[model samples]
Target: MAKKTARIKTDTHAVRLQTRDDVETAIKQIGDLQRQLEGLAIEQNNELAAITEKFAPKITALKAEIEPVQQAVQAWCESRRDELTQNGKTKTGSFNTGEVQWRQRPPSVGIRGVDSVLESLRTLGLTRFIRVKEEPNKEAMLNEPEIAGTVAGVTIKTGIEDFVIMPFEQEV
Candidate 1:
């Protein structure tokens, strides 16, 4: 006679358990997602910084451009005030204007800037002096060949130098 071996079957009510490999894989996937997110954040920050850096110079340059124009206006105003006092002294030998018309030709360029030069040359204070007339005098000094260069046309005044330009057509 042969001996029979006992057999047993496991029950379905036992708890399921996870392996170490599964836990490690989940942790690694989370770490990878966090690293990707951090990289994206850094890239976005760099792009923003580059854009701001590019515009900074243009903004500064624009401000620089306007400074010279402002300076020109300031110089013009200071010159006008000084001219008023000196011209008054020369004409009346004193500052007494109780009965004078203050409305006489408001300082060359709007009652402001470089009065002495304008007075000396009998011109209104302006960046350029151009004849507003449509036609030039045919027999005037502008037509003369000798001294025409001196009084021919508009005078351009920059801080560096003064320029005299003549043109067939007047600038309106």
Candidate 2:
């Protein structure tokens, strides 16, 4: 029987050039860097989206909140300015009718010409001074020059040379 010959092996330098370890190391480093970049990108995107969401609605809501207030303030300012800047508008029809009717006031009357000094008192406001005694010139009550006007249907007379001011008392 012939004996089987063993095959001879050669350590070729070229065949050993590309080792599995070097290839594995390079692949591992590349994979790690890729994973880190993906993580950083996801984190950045999340942060930016959150920041945008936080302020975007707030800006609109602030305008919505302030719009009515701004309009109201503007309206108030315009009204006040118009009121302060009043132009003279001559109101018709109700002239002198109720202009002096708002509140009770003292009455007075004035006179123009007369013969006697007491009879020249054309205007008189006070009815109380009607029956009062005269000063300096002592004269009879019925002999004075009668300046006549009425108060509450009661006829009053005075001889003063100036306006007679009535007491500021009236019925409601």
Candidate 3:
């Protein structure tokens, strides 16, 4: 096997606006390009909508044909599940065309009226079921930066800056 060579890229032609006139021209060009991009996106979406509208009726008909057949197959399989799965020894039944499986979803807990439930649990001495989460308080740390900064793993970051350019456009 031949060794693959890595292709490195370098920025040789970077934009450098020297004067106010050049900056103003660049902003005008950015606004024009943005308008062109928005026009192209609208055209592409119109074409996609036309294509979807053309095929939507056929898709609806196909789905209507499939639902009854799927229901029939599922009912037949469910009625003969004991024989198909060999008396619950397996979860899947293999046939010439494909295999069908019976799956049990994992159990989940649902809660409603959280405040009342918590109060009842506390009154009944069932605190073990109630969870208490303990984590670092970042807001408190921000309030007391002097004390928080003294910690070994924590560092206070400052003076972050970003450069942004917005080209103004007039609505017609």
Q: Which model scores highest in TM-score?
A: 3
TM-scores for candidates 1 onward, in order: 0.28, 0.27, 0.72
lDDT-wise, the better of 2 and 3 is 3
Q: Model 1: per-residue lDDT, tens digit, 1-172?
A: 3323222233334324388777566555555565566569999999999999999999999999999986785565446644645655533222353311122555555444556655645554453553445775545643564555456573433345333222122122
TM-score of 2: 0.27
| Runs in model 3 lying further than 4 Å from the true structure | 1-15, 44-51, 112-125, 150-153
Clashes of each: 5, 11, 0
Best by lDDT: 3
- What's the C-alpha lDDT at position 50 in model 2? 97
Pairwise lDDT winner, candidates 1 and 3: 3
Note the residue pairs that clash in candidate 1: 76-113, 79-114, 80-113, 80-114, 108-125
Question: 1-172, model 2: which lDDT tens digit per residue?
Answer: 4333222233333333278787566555555565566569999999999999999999999999999986886576455543433432322112243211123369977655533434433254444444556563324423443522322443445443432212221222
Q: Give the TM-score of candidate 3.
A: 0.72
Considering only N, C-alpha and C atoms within 3 Å, which residue pairs clash in candidate 3? none
Worst 10 residues of 1 by lDDT: 163-172
